[model samples]
Target chain A: MHFMTALRAAWQQRDSLLCVGLDPDPARFPAHLQGRSDAILRFCTQIVDATADLVCCFKPQIAYFAAHRAEDQLEALVEHIHARHPGTPVVLDAKRGDIGSTAEQYAIEAFERFKADAITVNPYMGRDSVDPYLAYPDKGVILLCRTSNPGGSDLQFLEVDTSKGRMKLYEHVARTVAEDWNASGNCALVVGATFPAEIARVRALVGELPLLVPGIGAQGGDIAATLAAGRTENGTGLMINSSRAVLYAGKGEDFAEAARRVAEETRDAINAYR
Target chain B: MHFMTALRAAWQQRDSLLCVGLDPDPARFPAHLQGRSDAILRFCTQIVDATADLVCCFKPQIAYFAAHRAEDQLEALVEHIHARHPGTPVVLDAKRGDIGSTAEQYAIEAFERFKADAITVNPYMGRDSVDPYLAYPDKGVILLCRTSNPGGSDLQFLEVDTSKGRMKLYEHVARTVAEDWNASGNCALVVGATFPAEIARVRALVGELPLLVPGIGAQGGDIAATLAAGRTENGTGLMINSSRAVLYAGKGEDFAEAARRVAEETRDAINAYR
Candidate 1:
């Protein structure tokens, strides 16, 4: 299925903007699941099983799996998401950026090896680095624009000359992606929910393009401000990601239920703004 | 061993500044090796074995392995280089960029999971994103400054306000990395070999720091110009990498030998300039 189509369908059908980031930290796993050989997979699949109905997307951070030597489990987790919960897009939170054939290899890692519906990519390398991912017409390519972290301003907020005149580095990225880089219309911008004003600025630049807004739960971002700034004309188009807060919501046997409760509250909270 | 110490030792001991990049593309393997389950590992280890004595460092492009779900092979390949060629440092050419704990996960992925001596990272997200990698005081962190592609100049060459004065984006990264981000004294910059003048500029900015110069071999870069522009005060700081040109130098029974020949030529060509 086309990623954009799937994403939109997920947004409408599920009535959700929530994107649960499956960042499986095995050390923080419930006592029962911790140290199990298949802990990362089991913990993540349980999370998906709990909140699959409430999210527009499931973003599995790859480093978490790779760090644990559980990439095989990540492959299985994505397959699990597909088999169990149809229509929910799986965005691999890889933030990969490289040029030419290297970029193609990464695209294959996320799109082919893991079967991600979309992937988050770094845009600092410019258009060429992202072209390979864009080549997969059905897959979504989310470019990092204004990030949530404080140090994101170190380079992202610098003034740079654009065809439209001097603009901040990230603003230039936003305008470039909105006007020139979104050739196949399969591109999205990662504008952090923490930066509501920047999100509005990005939304203004790239009208109707989806935004994967991380930094909501553990990062202390408000859904109200985010929705006010980034919602499209139809009051949609944001996949607000929450990782630590949702994934580690509980530490007992009822962890999955605790995850579902948080997912419900978060999803409904997002809809309240809409 | 400290990555910097190991790197300098390998440079002097091997009398080669060449960093042979292990980027295995299965389709490009010898006809006999093609379709074999262990083709990626077999081909890469053969290349490593062939050139183990002739390199300062061995850089394995992580995407090539992850794309093929051969990350375990990558682990074994790194182990092979370490066990077989004791002094050669392995710089995992990951180019990963993220914030905080996510960065830690990537650090574990590179430093712990693959047991790499050092890793290449993207500096676009700034100091905070790179801090976790720098936390491993002995491991080297190579940050992307000016890349070796046509699109690299798109953002890299743009004018930006530095504390010193207005300069190019890449120059800011070079300067920042030189003065501030190298507090651990484990940081290096990737100044692509394609642009020699820019390489000189980066070298001038970051005095004694090492530079990982790519874009040689298949990328059509000039070694003499690169060496002239990027070599340190002692003429021993750069680890020049060549991937495809060396890795696929032959496709028959003599493929490993062909790879070794190219590796020798590249190392010799680089040393000739020095």
Candidate 2:
């Protein structure tokens, strides 16, 4: 199945718009699973098994694995999850952006090495840095517009004069990516949930393109406001990501089940918006 | 030695402020050296040996090595270069940026995994994302401002309203990075040679921070104009980079010598700017 169709099916079956982020900090991995790639893989396996029925997708932050040079192992873990549950999409959270040649290599690493359905990318390097990734018809490229961190506001919210009028920097980025660089295939914007009004404004610029909304749980963002600003008329275009709040739900052996509970709560909250 | 002192010594010895990039594309690797990691390592070793006295540094584009999953071999190549000629700094050209936690991992990968004295970074993720890398007092973080690519003007030259005054987006980046994010230690700006006036303006904003200027040789940027725009009063703060022009000098066994000749010529052209 194509990525969008598989994403829709998973969202429908799980009744979830939540995307659980598996950014396994070695320091935060269950005590028993520390320092072993196999244990990390198994922990991811159990988490996927339990939360797979509750989340629309899983997003594995690639740096956590890359630090240990466990890139291939993480690739296998992502593949294992898909093999076990064929319809759940995986979004590899690697914020990569460079020139065209380098971007092509990164595309190979994300799509061929890891087989991710979608990938997060930084848009700072300009449109050409992202073209190689968006060239793939079945994959999704979520451009970083406004990030969740405290310092993100330093530059992302700067007002700029465009041909249209005075606009937020992110609005220009959203307009450019939506209208120009998104022709060949799947493209989405990453708008932090912390800024609800900006989210609505960016949504206006992006029109109908899907958005990956981060900062809902651990980042202290209001779910109601985020949903109010970001929800599409069809209720399927937003992927709300909750990382530490869901992944580190429990420190003990029942961690996977605890993750499922958090996932369920997140899913229910998103569903309430409908 | 600290990065600044080390860079200073290398600059004096080479009598040139040039860095040759070792981005060995597999398709462009010598025919005799194709399909072998050892051959690639040997190719890099000979280039270092040949141009060790002519250039200030060697910048191996990490994507070229990373694309092959030859991370360990690349690490070995770095060690080989340092051991053969002790004072030459290795600049790992990987434009990495993410959150604080993820950024720490990239710092480890560049400073520990590859042992690069400096690494290029994307500033789109904001201050916290860059702070982790800056925490390493001895390793330099080169922030991407105006890149050399044809489409770089898409976002870098954006006019933004900031608290200080009206500024280009990249100028804003340079100001933020140089003023706010340079607290922990080593920091530099990447001002591409493609935009001469922006380079001069960013240099004025950044004030004395080293600038790693790319886009010299293969990118059609005029060397004399780049020198006039990028040079500090002391003429000691620029690391001009040339990759394809030097690395792809020849396709045969004589490639290393050809690389050295071009590196020498390029170095002379840069020194003439003073």
Candidate 3:
């Protein structure tokens, strides 16, 4: 299935916009799983088995797994998700960007090796850095615009003089990606939930494209306000991500179930906005 | 040895600030090394062996090795460079940046796993994101400020509204990282060789911190002018990088020797400015 259809299916079945972030830190894994790649795989399997039905999608922070000497484990993690729950889309949060030729390899890694339905990318390298990823018709690319971090304001909010008159740097990014590079309609913008006004402006620029809204949980971005800023005539384009708050709900054996409860709450919270 | 001392040693011996870049593409790996990791390893080993004595440092662009499914090869490539040329420092060209805890893992990976003396980073995540890497007193952290890409101006040149007045965003990043985060003197900035005035301006702010100036050969950045703008007191803190111009100088069996010749020429080009 195409990424858009997969997203629509997720929104309809789970009745939630919640994307459970699986950034499994080795230290945070269950005691039995510490420092062992097998154990890490097992923990992810259990989390997927338990909460697979509760989330619209699963977002795995690649750095956590890549940091371990077992960078190869990322393949197992993504494959496990696809094998058991074929309907659930996976977004690999790699935030990768490089030169033209190099970016193509990352596309193959994300779309071919891991088979991620979507991948987050850094736009620092410019449009050519991202063109290779956009070539994949079935996959989605989430471009980082205004990040959830406080220091993001240091750069993302800067105003510049373009041929189109004075414009915020991110607004230029949104307009270019939406109008120029996104021929396949697989482009998405990562607008932090903390800044609702900017989110609204970016949403207007990137018309029907998807918006991957992070920072709802530990980042303390207001969900009601975020939803109000991002939702359009069709409200399924936004994928709200909550990582630590849901995944590390309880440190004990019932952690999976605890995760389920928080996932449900987060789901209800977004649904209430609808 | 301290990173600055190592840089100075390479400079005094070679009388050049050029660091030859090794970004070998798998498809372009000389015909003899096709389809085999060991062959690629051998080729890189020879490249280091040939060019080590002529240049101050070797920068292995991680993206090339990472493009292959065999991520294991990237580790071997790093090991080969260090094993063959123990005196020459290896700069792992990975522009990595994450939160404090995650940044620590990257630091360990770049410094310990790969044994890189320095690595490139993005400061968009703020001081906390970069502080973990600076904890290692021996290694240097080269933060991206004004990049060489065409779209770099989109955000790097943004005019910020501040207490003092409006200032370019890259200027703000330079001031903040230098004043607040440069406590260890291991912190540096990547001022693209393409932007000479920005290079001069940022140099004034940071004061003698190492600058990794990329975009010399294929990217149309002028070597003579860049050296003039980015030169330090002793011509010791500048590590100007030239990748394709040196490494891919010849596609034939004599590629390594061709690489060494070009590297010598590049070293001469920089020294001529002094």
Candidate 4:
């Protein structure tokens, strides 16, 4: 099934829009898993096991895995998630952007090697950089729109003169990707939950297309504002992601259970807003 | 020594600005090494050995290695370059960008794991994203400015309203990076050789800073125009990169020797222009 179809199905079946980001920093892992070589895999598996029922998807940031040279563990984590929670989608948050052939290689790395249902890409290099990932019609390509970082405004918010007159760089990106790209209907935009106004602007630009909203929990995003600004017309197209707040909820042995509680709370909070 | 000092030393010693790109595509490997598990390492070692003296730097595009799960080979290649040709810098073309901690992970992946003297970065996430890579004062952080692809103009050329009135987005990037960032003098910009005018524009913007110019050989970029447009005022500070035209110059046992020949010619052509 196409990534969008699978995502929607998972959302409906789970009745949730929460995407738990699996960014396992060794320093933040529970005390029990600290020195273990397989800490990343073990921690992520337990998190998935704890919160699988409450989430429509799992978004794993590749940096945390690559830092420890635990790519094999990452691959295993994705496979385990698929086997354990068959319908839940996995979005690899790589944010890769490169020239044509290199982009193709990154696509293979994310989709074939890691087996992610979808992947995040950076649109800085323009069309061909993103086209390779978009070529996989069955997979989803989430482009970075207005990001959540403090430095996000450094470039993303620059007002650019287009045929449509002056607009922010992120707005231009949304319009271009929604109109010129997205022919395969597998395209999505990543608008930070921290920037609800930008999220609303992106939502207005791209109607029902999925929006992967990050920066909700630990990043101090207002949950109600995020849901109100990011939801689609049908109230079901935003994937609110929380990584540190849920993953590092407890540093003790009951970490997984703590993660579950936080996941539950986050999901219900999102549902209440929706 | 710092990346720029090392790069400048290598350039003066070799009297060349050529940076040979080691992007080993398995499908394009010579027949003798086609099925070998160590094909990537062997192919790259041979190329490096053949052309070590003809260039100032060696850039191994991480995507190709990551695609075939040959990161080990990439690590080995960097070691081989440093051991065999210590003065020649190795710039790993990673183009990585992320949040602060995630960026830290990528820095570890590039500098600690792969041992690259310098690495390319994407500035889409702005200051904090590039800051982690820049924190290592000894290493080089080359930022993506104006790319070589046809789609580069899609967003890069859009006129943005900045403090200095309406300027292109890339110009804004150049000004910000050159003026605000680069306190450590490790920052550089990537301006594609395919667009000589853009290269000139970027060169003019970032005075004496180094430029990693790709798209020279296989991508049909003009050598003379690139040299004239990209060179610093002192006829230096440009790392002209060519991948396919040098790597896939021959399809037989003479492949390495053929690669050396092409590298020599490209180096000489660049020298002539300088």
Candidate 5:
């Protein structure tokens, strides 16, 4: 199935807009699993099992796994997610970009090696760097537009002059990717929920393209404002992601139950806004 | 030793500016070494051994090894370079960037795991995304400025309005990184050898900061123009990299010798220009 079709089916089945980010910091794993060799894998599997019915997708940030030399565990986690939760898509948040041949290698890394349903890519190197990812029509390519961090504005908010007119660098990226790219209909934009106005602007530029909205929970973004600015006409094009808030809801052995409760609450909260 | 000090010592000792890129494409590996489990490692070590005396630095593009599930080989290659060619620096061309915590993981991947002396980074995510790499006072953080690819113009050439009036986006990056972000003096800029004018512009913007210049050999960059545009006042601060042209110069049993010959010619060509 195409990435969008699978994503939509999961959204409909779970009635959820929440995407749980599986960023398992080894230092933050539950005490029981802390010393285990498979700690990250075990922690991520529990989180996925707990929240499978409450999420539209799962995003595993590759850096966390890479840091611990657990790439094999990452591969296992994605396969487990596919086997246990068939419809819910897995987006590997790798944000990789490079020249042509190197970009092809990254595509193989994200899609073939890790079996990610979608992957985030950096747009700094422009079209050719991104074309290899977009070539995978069954997979989604999420390009960074405007990020959530405090220093995001350092370069993204610069005013750039284009043939159309003058617009912020992020706006230019949104419009160009929405119009010039996206030929296969598998492209998505990453617009931080903290920047609701920028989210609205990106939504306007790229009509119903999926926006992976981070910063809703731990990054201090308001859900009401995010929904007001990011949702599509039919209210289904946003993936509001919350990592730390849902994963660390409880410190003890009931962590899975706590995660489930938080996931359900976040899903309900997003649904209420929708 | 500091990265720049090591790099300068190597440049002065070798009397060369060429950086040999060890991008071992399995499909392009010589016939005798093709099917071996250690093909990537053997191929790269052979190239490094052959060309170590001719080049100032060895750049192993991580994608080439990562594509083949040979990251262990990459680690071995860096260790080999450091042990065999002591003064020469190894710049891992990773082009990685992310949020703070994730960026720290990437830094560990490049520095601790692979033991690269310098690593390339993408600047689209701004200051905080880059700080983790900069925190390593002895390592080098080479930021992507004007790339050599055809699609680089799609974004890098866009005119952006800064406080000091309008300039290109890449210029702004050079100025900001040189002026604000180089507190540790470990920062460098990647200005493609393919665009000599932009290289000159970037060199002017970031006064004495090192420039990692790719696009020299197989990418069709003019050596004399690159030297004229990128060289510092003392005829240093430029690392002109060539990958395919040097690595795949021959397809037979003498491939390593062929690589050494090409590397020597390229190094001499660059030195004559300087």
Candidate 6:
């Protein structure tokens, strides 16, 4: 099935736009699960079990797993997500970009080895770097547009001379991705939830393409504003990601229960706006 | 010791600016090691041992290792590089980019986990995404400026309005890294060996900061032009990279010897221009 179509199916089936980011930090794990070697997988699966019904997808940031030397755990976590909820998509947040054969290797790593339905990429290296990922027609490629970080404007805000006159770098990225880069119809843009106006601008440029928003909950982005700017005409086109807030909702024995509670609350809040 | 200081030491000791890339691909491996599970590490370590004396540095691209689940081999290879020739710098060609805590995790992955002296990164996200990597004062951060690939001009050549007036995106990146982002003096720019003119442009922009030059071997970049345009006043400011031409120099049992022969020839060719 086409990745975008699958995602739309997931949105209708689950009736949610929340994407739980499985960024398992061992240091922040609850007390009982702290010392175990399988804590990363165990903690993540418990959350996955608790929140599978409340999300459109699951995004696992590769750095978190790679930092702990647990690539194997990440592999397992993705398998668990697939087995538990075949409807939920997995977007590996690798942010990888390179040229030629090296980019091909990264594409293999994200799609073939890790088995992600989609992956986020950095576009700094230009078209050939991203072309390899686009070759995977059934997999979505999300490029960073206007990021939520304060220092995001360092290069993103630079006014560049385009054919359509002067525009910000991020705006150029959005226009480029929407037109030239989305021949496969599997391309998505990552517009931050914190910047609702930029998100809206990106939406206007990209049409009905999904946006993988990252600055919600712990990052302090407004839910209503994000939905008002990001939703498609049918009211579902944003994969609003909340990691630390949902994963570390409680520090006690009933941590999974607390995670479920927060997941549903957040889901309902997002739905209220929709 | 600082990474830049160490690389300079390598230039003096080895008398070569060649950075042989260890991007191990099993399908391309010689007949003897074709089906071997240990092929990735074994192939790479032989390349390391063969050319350790001929080159100033070794760059093991992480995507190649991760694609084949040979990250452990990459870890061992880095240790081997350090153990074999303590003076040789390992620049892990991981073009990583992210923001905040995620960026810190990537920092740990590159410096702590992989133990690379330097790592390549994408500059699209601006300061905060790169700040975590820059925080490691003793390590080097190589940002993509003017890449060799054809698609690199898609955005890099855009004239951006900067404080110094309108300049190409790559020029702005070169200036920013040289002036603002190098308080710790650990930043370097990657200007393709293919575009000797752009290399000269970047060199003029960034002054004496080093440039990690790719596009030398398989990418059809001119060695003499690269050296002339990229060298500093002292004639030792470029780390010219060659992967396929050096790695696949031979296809037989004596492949390592052929690799050494090609590596030495390439190294000497680069030195002649310098």
In terms of DockQ, which candidate is strongest? 4
lDDT of 3 by residue, A177-209 (tens): 898778888888888898888889988888878
- TM per candidate: 0.98, 0.95, 0.92, 0.99, 0.99, 0.99
> lDDT tens string, model 6, A56-78?
99999999999989999999999
Question: In candidate 1, which residue ranges exceed 4 Å CA deviation?
Answer: none
Off by over 4 Å in 5: none
Q: Go through the candidates in order and give each one's C-alpha lDDT.
A: 0.92, 0.83, 0.79, 0.91, 0.92, 0.92
**Residue A229 in candidate 3, Cα distance off native in Å:** 2.8
Task: Give the Cα error of residue A171 in candidate 1, in Å.
Answer: 0.5
TM-score of chain A of 2: 0.95
lDDT of 6 by residue, B202-274 (tens): 9988889999999998999999999889999888999999999999999998889999999999999998998
TM-score of 6: 0.99
RMSD of each: 1.0, 1.8, 2.5, 1.0, 1.0, 0.9
Candidate 5 residue pairs in clash (backbone atoms < 3 Å): none
Worst 10 residues of 5 chain A by lDDT: A25-34
lDDT tens readout by residue for model 1, A106-221: 99999989999999999878889999999999999999999888889899999887778998999998888889989899999898878899999899889899999999999988
TM-score for chain A, candidates 1 onward in order: 0.99, 0.95, 0.95, 0.98, 0.99, 0.98
Error of 1 at B116 (Å): 0.3
The regions of model 6 sitting more than 4 angstroms off are: none
Q: Which portions of model 4 show Cα errors greater than 4 Å?
A: none
Candidate 1 residue-wise lDDT, B1-274, digit = tens: 9999999998888999999998899999999998988899999999999998999999999999988989889989999888988988999999999978899999999998899999999987888999999999999999999999878987898999767999999999999999999988899999899999999999889999999998998998999999999887677889999999999999898999999999999899999988
At residue A60, give the lDDT of candidate 6: 96
